[model samples]
Target: MSGKNVPFQDLFVTMTKVAKDAVPIGGLVLIPPKNEHQLLFVLGGTAKVQVDHKHSQPILAADTHFIIKPGQSLQITNQGSHLLDISIIACEVVQLSRADHKLSAASVKTFAYFQYETVSHTPRSLRAMVQKLQEPSTFIDMQKLLENQFLFQKLIYLLMDSHASQTDADPRHAVESTIEYLKLHYDEAITIEDLAGIAQLSRRWYTTLFKEITGENPSDYLIRLRIDKAKELLTMSKESLYAIARKVGFEDEHYFSRRFKQKVGVSPRFYLHNRRILGTTVTHPELMYLLGTIPIAAFSPDQEFPSYLLEAFKQVPKLNNSHHFDPEYFKPFKPDVILAAEWKDYENYDALSRIAPTFLLPSHNDWRDELTDVGEILDKKKQAHRFIRWYDDKRDEVREQLKLLTNNETVAYARMTQEGLIVFGNQSSRGKILYTELGLIPPEKSLLHIDGKILSVEQLAGLGADHIILQIGEQADSSREALLQQPGWRKLMTSPTSRIYTVGHREWYNFSFSPLSTGFAMQHMLQMFERGVVR
Candidate 1:
């Protein structure tokens, strides 16, 4: 019987079953039903009583009792051919306070002074209660059982006192407790002193014993644990390196990176390339986005991302160059593969490979072929070809869509900087989308040879294009607003059949080379042409 069927109020003995049975030779009663706490008393014959592995050899003698706690099993055997009379008490503590009336689960407190693994000798005072319990009774009154329950509570207190003393005296238990504490509080700022306090040992003594028990020094173990956790975060999320440093208990980002590189053998930026599975870390955000992969972190985001690339990379954290080349910073976001651009003098190449498989693609020129090379490395060759085809088709589609404008008006792409009005070439700053993709002709005087050629404001009017796409770069640093108020600017703005359309300066510059960026520029320019300039 269990506590479920036993009706209880205040403090009382919920369930009791008494029996006297005889077992023949070679008989076994292995692990019978037991309550939260049970008392097994040997009334007459000798029987082997075993609770667990450690409780063996402490035989049950006449007039002696053995206690069993929950989760522990009891095995009784009659080794000799003799009848064994045994008294078993199934006792459970129940809710006693009136305050517990509305509680969903009753509070059951245990008072025991011994570990379940060890055997305890019955005290002298408990003998009287054992004698009263041994009497043969098939039926018991509920009200009278409450009066006797007082003795059970008293028995629990005495056992608890004994257990506390034994547990405190054992040095092994203290070490185990300290290990458990470290596992739970590893993420918090913890010191050797705190661990020593948990173990109740002097700093030097605790350090020696911790190494003895765990085989590694306490500080080394803690660092390894933190790095392991950092590795997990690096693989799973797109959190910034700084945020990750703070999370794993490294307040100084640089020191965390140094420690990570020391243990992991690569700087955080390069280490990002390799993850557990097919995870990605790319230096080229624009190209990776076009290739259908969200990079865990990007190196050159150019201060901000374009509107089109924002949705894909909005959650992707930026990896700044300020921390130098420490690969340990990327340990938390354990990337499986790192995609990087070919460098002029790449120093972290070896370091990156140590962290994860790092692939360096061509940085400049022949970008279309470079896209395919990156695809082969990333195992997304099919998607790469499909994207190329889709981009070609979109270029043709936009070319046809802009037929009216292309036939009549030439487009001019220029940026207003602090130096002067800078014009762009077909190789950079959305020039390919305007001239090559959409088939928009450039004006004869539009500085087509120079990538970022600066010219006077008066010289801008010489460009024969019917429309001007002006990119305002670094608005805070530029005098474009004051220039626009000049008479020369007014004349340019009021030119017949010509319109001035403004766009983000740095954003347009960064979107020059990637397929995704080209697509965004194409669609935006087409919309502007079809709807006319708002201002």
Candidate 2:
């Protein structure tokens, strides 16, 4: 089986399953298991453990022993300065499985390699031993196994006994040991002392080792772990922010906000609403589903959502990765009836027609009737009719529940508009793109965070704004050219006065959806705008 398939519960595979002093950060470990496991001997210098907190004491030498039989857990920490060598090893848990069980768990000794070096590059003695292990009969000979075990034991003993003599030694072992403890007990309040005990070393030694091995203080790593968990939750759950904060070991939402902002560059709410802050006029459940998954992915060059739909239809778990922009992102799956605004997009997903019919959704919205016409093309005119009824039900529910929030009889739909980037629709939610794929900031009155200094009419024209909305007009420049360039008299036109005020306003300012809705309207309006049937 692939490593990705393995469900890891608090355990990370070690790069080196068997290692020596490697490097110590001033701590020794003594893992007192609740169950029995193999008998393990930790040999190193001064160490501190957390069985008793508020202390960082010295560790005993090779003479100290802890039986790590099957189903048992062990810990050792060594805190020293210069490369203090500490030795750690795992023995067969079968030998001590049920006897006074004190270890954590008993399972197959699954090891992982983060990195490794060739035996030829090892010390002279280790090189010779490795070469011997490669001999043709090594696997068949029982004596060779015994000899190999004995040699490994001797090597660990030598590294621990003599190499771990300095106060500040290599701290990789201590760092790794702490990582192990953190992985196991993230849900609990863990401290340096607890980690020290795991490594059979002193608190000071453990802290030092943690830094040496991980290149950061232990506390920093813990925060990172918490932040990562928070991110996963934000994307997957509809949990309240306070609840999520508490779940991630943050009791205060405000503090969590600060930390999350510092780490992720966005607030929790933004991450959650990035793709889904939508207000729709459609109320029918089936219609809502159809519209939400509009299959308008005709030009989604990434091919992402199509494949995702294919897998979803097949009940496969989402296979997304951190690289969200990968080009082949959506090639893995296929979909039926892709809502194409353009024929080009239809061709893009045409490769999957053998699997299912990929048709386009009708793209007209001058009034609501076009929706039915669009559905009719898919041979689902009745479905479109039913949608309006479903929409009414949802609209009534919203009006009943959220009536106090607004004074208007017609509900206002707010969401990021594609043209205005972060703009929200001010009119009704029905019959338009209620949302786009952009994060929406909740409506709150505050000074615009845009440029502070007001630009004059001439300055506005220089900046190339289609038109300008004048708060008040005051002239600073006397030049006629400058006055002419000023936009103070310009009309910032919108849909209400679109055609009526054509002389003073620009045509593009008549708000509408993307080429999608506009093109749809154009197709339907062709006869009205230019008499007769046209494709």
Candidate 3:
């Protein structure tokens, strides 16, 4: 009860009981007070224990222990995924007079309450003794009762030894205490040596253990905490950069700017404006560019840009290779914002966010909606709406021309790749322009919803369309020649009722998805219809 050690003759233990409990995930265990003290040991898993329904403290497996006083209620919760296993030893303790070695009647009657203390990292021998108490026993037998009393005495001795060896306790407790201190005083002027001294560990050992537990060295962790606080201030308040720098523990604004850029990939001023944008998808860069701002870097898997945007993006650095974005490769660019499409690797979002504020855009069937969302991110809502209106007006102009040119004829769009011939659906880039915008009918209703499907020669022969627009790939000339030699190709070409038009695969594939590219695709399709180059 007191910090001082109780003499061996000054205490008596009786009615000792040991119970083991298993609490499942998200389960709660309540231990009612029976006018007896308890020694709670976490055998496995972790638990949050609250005394009398007050604030709780975490008890880690095999590393912490609590001595609950008599008449104290306990509320234990298992917040982790696994079962929380704990052993509670309850016993009645009577005070004895130290001088005469006899029970103190007055002390027993008064039962003065004392402060409760936690004893961490008890000796290993105490675990075996507690486990022994869990064995089946007949309490009515006097021998068993005496055995329990003797075991309790040994347990008390082990507890005393734990208290005596406080200086040699687990270093984790000291390190954890230091971590709490750092969290509370992050903005204060603190040194690594001071933290190590507070943790009672050598500087090297302290840093090693800190990194092991927190995944960051002390300096980095502290700096990150300060930077996070600075970000909040920057967003919520109009504090001068120098004032913010001083408030978040940096003495110089220049040093703060450098650290902020290193951690956040942008200066404070750039963060507010989000000026230097990075695009993680091909469409994202085009959308941003159409919104009147060129991305600092963009994904260029083949080191090629859309023909319509090539001149504008000729100076932008490529951020990805073969459609794969490496966060390390783009760190030096220091973008203020990153626009990523949902099709990119979901796992890299966190890493990308660390470099800059990253927004993951979901796949939208309509490129206009994607542009509007990007506009919201860059605060260019008006530009996005204006572009959509321009596209709609252009689409209307083309749709009227196609109404007279095609005269209700069915049209199918296809692309020739090295693999084979693939047809596009109404929802696809080129397909949308042909079917939705220009109001062309597909040979079958199923093609209206199909995104993209590969067709064998047999399937191609059965496709009953008035006209077919085939885009030829750069390296698929041989494949195209082979297809032309097939019987299905000959039959389709010979049909006087059907017409076939050809276009460049590079021009159509790259310039068919984003707002700007879709506009180009419309003009390209109209030109092909006017030229009427049947194959």
Candidate 3 structure quality by residue, lDDT tens digits, 39-110 = 788766778888765455656565457778776778888877788878888877766545433222222211
C-alpha positional error of residue 432 in candidate 2 after TM-score superposition, expressed in Å: 21
Task: Compose the digit string of candidate 1's lDDT tens values, residues 1-535.
Answer: 3442232334343434434455565576665545466667665566787755333546665555676766567788865556665666776655455542221111111211222434455565666666665554434675556545555555555544444465657665555556655564466776788666655678888888788888988888888777766665565456888888888878888998999998888877666564332222222566666776677776543576656666776887766634355655556666666665556314555556556556656566545676787677655678889988888998898898887755657778887877778777676545665676677778773355556667666777777568888877764344877887789888888888668888774456555566765667678778888888645
lDDT for model 1, please. 0.63
Residue pairs that clash (backbone atoms under 3 angstroms), model 3: none
| TM-score to true structure, per model | 0.45, 0.28, 0.59
On the 0 to 100 scale, the lDDT of residue 3 in model 1 is 44
- Write the residue-wise lDDT of candidate 2 on 205-317 in tens digits: 77777877778777787777677677656644558889888888787999988998887678877744432211111111113234343321222211232322344323322
On lDDT, the stronger of 2 and 3 is: 3
Query: Which candidate tops TM-score?
Result: 3
Off by over 4 Å in 3: 1-197, 200-267, 301-303, 319-326, 427-433, 473-478, 510-512
Worst 10 residues of 1 by lDDT: 103-112
